[model samples]
Target: MKKRLITLCSTFIFCVGVQAQEFTPKQLEQVKQVRENALNSDLSWQLLESITTEVGPRLPGTENDKKAVAWAVEQFEALGFDKVWTEPATFPHWRRYHESARIITPSEQPIHLTALGNSVSTPEQGITGEVVLFETLDELIAAPQDSLKNKIAFINYRMNRHVDGNGYGPAVRARNNGAVEAAKKGAIAYMMRSVSTTEHRFAHTGGSHYQPGVNKVPATAISNPDADQLERLISSGHSVSVNINVQSEDLGEGTSYNVIGEVTGSEFPNQYVLIGGHLDSWDLGTGALDDGAGVALTMAAAKHIKAVAQPKRSIRVVLFAAEELGLWGAKAYFERHAKSLGNIVAAAESDFGAGLIYGFESNVTANALPIVRAIAKQLAPLNIEYIRANAAHGGPDLIPLRERLNAPIFALHQDGTDYFDYHHTANDTLDKVDPIKLKQNTAAYAVFAMMAANSKNKITNK
Candidate 1:
């Protein structure tokens, strides 16, 4: 009798557990409805077209950047977002005045190059010296100081292409630190192979860091083809002397701002789902794939959510400033809004080029995995997978929030196979974007942001 009673209790418990696990038919229907709505939305493509065509390249502290900010404000307001505003920040002003390079010895030929952001200008007449080649930065560091004295050092670190472009971070170090490192070794000037994977005649221009106390040097990046040609000449037992001139300078600080829009929630108004892309780009291209795509996607997603009625938590869109030269915009914003960080539920950034999103990862509590998984499953129709992982670096714009605020960042991994080809190059323009892929990315963001805003689980740090 005792054994039978125990068995009956066990069966009852199992039955209750199974009942709890089943979802209500109404809830399942709601999920399907949300997915369908996102798939059908056309706002994504429209937004991309408008921004890319109207604003073009938005280099930091330039006229294009200011124009982009105004355009974004108008776009958000036109989309009927409940609130639109701008937060002020300051950014260092640097402009590319002129860039030219030529091989003076071995052969007299012009080499294509672009000045790196924040690079100093050479003398009015420019600098001419023998070329010293370093396959890597470490090699240059190991060389005798006398070897680099009165010479122009060239660092040739090539970026490897991958589906995720995971090589970009490390590969970019050459561009970021190469100039300063060479200056320390007594080089008169520095040049590097553009941080790109493909061999192209177009030079890639990006930001470089000069150590605070070190003297700044003229720096530029040569196109892959030009770098290759220069390398061949040097390797063939020819003494190569080069003339380089880059008129880049710091013009003090200037005012910039982050554009913000919000769709107020129906319930948890204070809790937030933040999504954004940097509003700044390099001057070389239209910044279409670099960030115009990102801005458009975020705006479209926010507009859609607002049109459909507010979710359970507020959806905030932040178009950050000066992401190209530095993360000054993000840093300033974070400092001003530090207290509100605790209220932020989760954040996502779309800085990667306009590509179809394939997956998402988050640094959140383990208990929130089920909710995140459920959301990912909703996105499965759009071919988005979920990879639960910790967020260490969440791009430039989101880095401040991730570190200082300890905000959980969600990475919407995009197909970066072709991102490097146009990144920071003159080829990055509106024509490079595919409307179909833009739509797909918008759909992913819409579903993910909606689910995150509606969820009851708080993804707070433990």
Candidate 2:
């Protein structure tokens, strides 16, 4: 009983310490200036334009990926960051050669499609088989055993668009795990509709996984219009056969790097408030919306903070690598940094598309809520609202660290209603991102990152 009482007292004292930390009037003035400068600055747009136009697509472990690494280093050095470095990352290297799909039976027609990343190629002569269609992944899994033998399975699942981008949660299962499920039912190949909200002829490509024990199969994604036509044909009582040839080669694992830059603290230099975005992208486009914007946003934000005033804790900006190929860089970073998580006051990511930041969410302890709330009040000029909930995972790349330490990660939730339309498609070019929105995102990040890094509060409850 005595021990329990002592433990509770210690917990109370710890929480009190965190709760007592707050920004002074002078610090609040500094944060406001930082936010205002970010709003007027064109740094984010300029960086994004330069990256998308100069470096192009940064496919993992490819020559383009290497160039991107060099470009990041050069940019960071030019920006006068306190320190810049790269962490090693190893991931599977896959290349796309050719991808085509055609309906050979019932009627001759072409289906626009792109090969899923790391998907196995069809035979040299290609495979001609009846196309089996499913409305959902669940339907395909419920089909009889061996029903898809020597056949191509197509899952025509529709993805709904949302402001929060929550719709991607259910619809992406078709691409993430569809191949394995189809192989379980003896499918020769698997295909699906693009996980998009817009009905464009361009097919979106993403990574798909094949279970180790399951049979290998080529997988592809067709455009929404082609999927609609195929569904209509299926409902017309006419059997359809498709000849699909998706050529992709896996050249084994290759090394990449997680590029990092920092704004060193004036006082507690060892502690951090980290911000990041993935450096790699799909091969289809310049990755402007998916992550070029993120890269530019974080970098520009840290630069703005450095221009304003030196904070108490470091603001480290990381460009995670090979995120589209299954978080190779994120996992590597966690393995190297997990033990030092206590020093991280907060972590945030800007991977979502460039859009107006509408809401703010975080995973910090209750003791830090007031500090966050105060920051949110400052963010009001940007039209950001604070969500009371503490359930935040930071970003996809931050998953390992957040789960390991149960530490704080924050999100500046964007208006992602139209984000999926160009996601992973050939249309994900520079035009997809709005310049003002990118600046707004940068502004929001700069304020929050500066405030968190300068604060005396700890992110943990006790």
Candidate 3:
């Protein structure tokens, strides 16, 4: 009799737990409506095409960057957002005017290359030197002091392709600080194989920094095929000499704005869900895959949610500024709002390429798992699996937010197998994005945002 009573009690508790997370029939129907609308709508594609085409490359502090900020404000107003504004962001502005390279000895052949952001310019005639090749940055760092005097340092690290883009960090380290280290050895310039996974003859351009005491050298990236050719020439007992000319300038600190739009909530107006992507891009390409798609999809996601119903909390879409130059806008934003970070009930950013969202995960307290699981249930129909690990770092912009607070963060994992092929290169254009995949991405964000904003129980950080 006692055992039967215990079993009955356990069953009752389980039922209550299940009931605690179940959404109302009306809420479920609303979710379905939003999903269907996002899937059928071409709103995301329209926004992406408009920005990438009309605005072109939005390098930080450039004319196009100003245009992008203005464009975002105009777009927010046109979309009928409840509130729209901009926050100031200052960053060291830089520009690439021209770049050219070629092998000078053994056999003359033009090499494909581009100056890394913030790189110093070589003399008008260019800097010609014997090439000192190292397979990796560590190898270059371990070399004897002053071993590369008056030479051009080259690190040939090839990035790998992964569905999650795990190779970027390892390869990008060489791009970021390779020049500083090479300069330490008296090298006049630094070059590395592009941090890309493509065989095409296109050099990738990304942010690179110089140290205070270290001499600044001309930093650049060469196309993968060119790197391979240089490797072959060196291995065949031929001393390789090259001429590199890069014209760039670093303007003093420049100011930009982080454009933000919001949909007001019926209740809990102070609390909000943050979703957005950076508004700046590298100048080499149209910046479509790197972030234009992200900007458009997140904007459309919020609009779709507002169309269905105003959630219990607000949703804010922040188009961050100067992200490519560094996370300047995100840093300024988190610092400006440091005290009220608790208001961010949920946050996610879609900076990855417009690929199919295949998984969903969250970083929240155990008590909030019910809310997350409920959100995950709605996303399941969109083919997103619930990753119960409950540890989500979110996108790059969220790094500052994550460091500032234990705020609830989420990740809608997208398939990124081909992202690096065109990332930071001249080939990243509208044609690279598939409309079908972009639609799925839009629907996933809408479902997650709507459910997260409207859930009965508020999600809390770990």
lDDT of 2 by residue, 262-358 (tens): 9999898888998989999999999998799999999999999999889888999999999999999999998898678777788999988898999
The candidate, 2 or 3, that scores higher on TM-score is 3
lDDT of each: 0.81, 0.88, 0.91
Candidate number achieving the greatest lDDT relative to the actual structure = 3
Over 4 Å off in model 1, which ranges? 1-31, 390-393
| Candidate of highest TM-score | 3
Question: Model 3: clashing residue pairs?
Answer: none
| TM value for model 2 | 0.95
Q: TM per model?
A: 0.93, 0.95, 0.96
Of models 1 and 3, which has the larger TM-score?
Answer: 3
lDDT of 3 by residue, 1-462 (tens): 655554454433223344244466687789899999999999999999999999989999999999999999999999989999999999998988999999999889999999999999999999999998999999999989999999999999989999999999999999999999999999999999999998999999999999999999999999999999999999899999999999998899999999999998788889899999999999989999989999999999999989988878899999999999989999999999999999999999999999899999999998777777777777878888888888999998899998889789999999999999999999999999999999999999998888778878778999
Evaluation by lDDT, superior candidate among 1 and 3: 3
Report backbone clashes per prediction.
0, 0, 0
